[model samples]
Target: PDRIEILLGVGSMTVPRSSVEKVEMASPEQNRAIRNQWKTRYLLHEDYVPAGMENIARLLTAARDARDTARQAGSAHAADMKHESSLLARLERLRSELIRVSKRMQNASRTSSPAAYNAMVLEYNNLYAAYTVGIHELAEFRAKHPAPSDRFSFYLDSLDALRRAYESALVLPDSGQDADRARFLDRVARIIEDYSRDFSTTAVRSEHSESGIIVAVTVNDSTTGRFLLDTGAAVMTLTEQFARRLNLDTSSLPAIDIVLADGAQASARAVILPSVQVGSARCEHVEAAVIAQQPAPDIDGLLGMSFLRNFAFRIDPSSGQVTLTQFAPR
Candidate 1:
């Protein structure tokens, strides 16, 4: 039997190659090709985002570069900054107009007014072009300017919000999805909040792969071992061997039923951890389960939402940093 080794987030496992159906290798060229395809589909589609909007986008970029250069060289005036601000204001107005036109389009469809619907489509197309220009401008700006270490925590938070806003704008074909559009707008409102907070903290490096992130997690505030960060999992889980190695009292806990990823059923014991810490984020009274076996031998446990949901986190696969920040509730 040929043994095949696979790397988990924190550990490695060897399995029979005969048991596996197929395997694919990841390469830089493959990644670049995928990125190019997505860019053409979403960002460079002429039918979706008009040619005129691209001109506005170029102008906005020029204005931003000029303002930034002036500020960096200590020659920037109020008017230099105001130039970009004015363009932003105009973009916001266009977004609002697009929303209004979309609503009319939705209504016109219900009334079967072909002429009215066509007119609304024309208006939406025009407004969408302008909105696309603004979205791309801000996105490029953020990507070019990495937040300094002092502001990195909140910068990561705001970046996520901005990305969501841009994605929502791109997918919103017309105003029919008003609720979705409104949600994006609300997230955009929080971008400023993300910028206002300056929480300073150290980031933890993690071993990651295409499967997920694997990091050393501290259990009960003392013992540390390799654990997989699985946000989709409802609760934490530990293999029986790993739990025993840590000297945990698995027998004292109540038994609970768990469904495995392969649709198999298993039993485990529910245990409470006084403290569980991953990177800089920590939680107390965390619920966990101890199982007889895991798919891999080296992985001690699975870190679930109980520990992750408490903090705002960003996983940078390229950098291998899992940045976590305590967020203020909305």
Candidate 2:
């Protein structure tokens, strides 16, 4: 992942947006890949977010702001000592003291022991965040212009009860395995109520065989072209012969270092493909790697989740009607 990040940063990148120009209706197989990709992205936005997450975010932001203000204020301590008068000199000393204090605050913002402090205070801040959110509901219940709705009052009571439950859940008799499991379950419930399930699992599929990545050949690479379906791979990868068919400058692709599961490393040049058609699916402007001179198998290329997540997916060995959308990504 680190090596890929470097390549993405330094490699001569093609304008990925315009890589693929050819477009056509997806065959039955391609549609499945495209459909799954769409579902993955949709699930990301709708299902991955947490409950009361906004309040926690606000608390974290406030802590960060306080920390930043302390650091900036501390920077002036050196200049404070340079003052001509004794009183000014004293003020500078105070500035230096404030800098140290601000640093402590910055640490608290990080909540990483030295990076932060006052765990009890941090807990209170989190509590206040929840309280503030609940107050909105409380205020809505007692508005004078509105007729008192018993239902709204009940909602306020329910919100307060939830807050009490949250507070109680924070207390545990001991940090045993059972307690740990309960905490985990509580967090999951909170996530389900606040955020969606998609965040817990993204649309990444990894298949590790004794050989390596699970590459399924839908079409064997021919003198003309071929396609491979790969859900386990993280990125779309293609061979040099197929890339040459698109007329792109493969030389611009940087030689990347990739570590396989078995600690084996490989060097390969990366390129953005115009498009790839696998089974009934097609991906436009997909990023792929053109491996160095090697006898590769499993079709001409493998279409990974980056292309697969652009559409919904379903697999049935009986019918083999894989489908995908080759248009704008999900």
Candidate 3:
């Protein structure tokens, strides 16, 4: 035989069996290793796709098609943008020519020669009409490729194509209904997670802050302060000292009773700060708990889920860098 067709899940691939020195059924360990390798490549963990061969194949196929479509769309968009730029350049040149002709026509009319003046007027009218048409064409081109809509279409097309592929895969043999639904939901979740990083921002930890992973933050649109990144904390906490320095109106703000990390219950003022900023990531009108007692020494506040929820963030302890990816609008 020239080749051996091996059935892998629901899909089959032909390979030169002769090139293989040995052929043995893969052990459970070997199968797990192979799937693990694939899972990493597809960014889909074992729990994401369910425990079945056909479901695996379907997920892989959907991912592949979506990736391919994204690549093709990107290339096409690049070429289209280049073409549009060229068209704009030509329009600019035409406008420049029209301006030059208008100036010449004005000089001709002042020369006191009727024939020359008449000829210049005729030429100017023709040039103006042509320029008008060029402007209209340019406007049409821009309207055809509006920036926001073009970006939205690319994402929409990729998602729609992947969805359709997934739906088609559901009908394939060995794809159980429960398994298919799980895989589809997981795929959608991953896509949503990735999309959340679209407007991602990054910030470096402050070197001046000594105790913990402290980063620079803006409070109430005015005060710039250092805040600690405490994942354990449920909400944003501002130190009383810092709040007083900023002249925060604590009296009128709502009060929240919270248990301190040291197992002590404390009364804290709940105030909506005008804005809180971490690097390029900023969340406006943020609700923060102002504690009269200092949570830690020197730090102005604690960066908790109240502001962190707007973006998915990761802190590199070794490099002292905090990367923030905004998943939602303010």
Candidate 4:
């Protein structure tokens, strides 16, 4: 057979043999092993299109088409412009609903009964499908209308909202629900890829050493040095030598308490850096701490949340690269 048909609770889906990555016996042990091996590729019955999804898809498409027509009509057509505004508002409502339903679905997957979980899954699939349609429409709209416009920012806001929703969905418990986890990861990866392609992002090459992963960081647009990538650290931290090298007035800066990786508490001066740049991804008015001693002989400081929190960042060990995309709040 050139294709395979997967039976689902609601229906079934057929896929070409070329699209099928692997095949395993439908046994619990085999399923677990396959899930472990391919965490992000496994699919489940719940991943299929649920009943009533076709209608939802049609509704979303119609709404998007109507909005596109209204937008194309321009301001001369007052009624069509009003219709477009209405459709935009409806799409925004749909996005909000999708977020709310996904949160509930997350809870259901964790603690609900089988029947209750199934019900939530159906509702979630419908909303998620509609939300995806809305995202495509927004992407198309943005393509037609470039940046520096209010509408462009609005579309970006919608995309950011979807990204956050996907992130929240990724917070599932370790309950052997590999399919759901994989689905969320696949969506998050797509969103991250889309962000990299559509928006300004920075990828900085990192050095992995015994101490930790290190990347070059520029402080106040002047002092450039290597810093340990420490997500656990509360704020950007610099050794006294590096701080003085930057000509920072540490003497007048306020002091704060910080805990070292060794679980020792120490006092450090707090400094507000005018800017911190990791590759091209920059954050201004970053808070940092100036410690008396350097963390490592070659490392100047710790790149902490103060800098990283400004962006959605991913550290890839295999590639030894840190990808940073500006986090836009909805």
TM-score, each model?
0.41, 0.30, 0.42, 0.44
For model 4, residues 77-146, the per-residue Cα lDDT tens digits are 4344354455456555665565676677656654548888888778767765664565446435534542
lDDT of 1 by residue, 1-330 (tens): 599897632235799998989867647787667544543454333222332234333433343344334334322323343554565566556645765776667567735677777777777777766565664564354344422222333344444444454444555566454543444344434543443343324479898755568888988777898888887776788888778877775452336687765668789865556688876677665657789877455788788765765556778878998876753222
Best by TM-score: 4
- Per-residue CA lDDT of model 2 for 63-132, tens digit only, reads 3344344334334432442332343333334334434454445556543563246754454455444433
Pairs with backbone N, CA or C atoms under 3 Å apart (clashes), candidate 3: none
**Model 1, global lDDT:** 0.60
> Could you tell which candidate, 1 or 3, scores higher by lDDT?
3
Give candidate 2's total backbone clashes. Answer: 39
Error of 4 at 293 (Å): 1.9
By lDDT, the candidates rank as: 4, 3, 1, 2
| Regions of candidate 2 where Cα sits further than 4 Å from its true position | 1-224, 260-263, 278-282, 293-298, 325-330
Q: What does the lDDT read for residue 96 in candidate 1?
A: 57
Each model's backbone clash number = 0, 39, 0, 0
Regions of candidate 1 where Cα sits further than 4 Å from its true position: 1-202, 328-330
Q: Global lDDT for candidate 4?
A: 0.65
Assess candidate 2 and give its TM-score to the true structure.
0.30
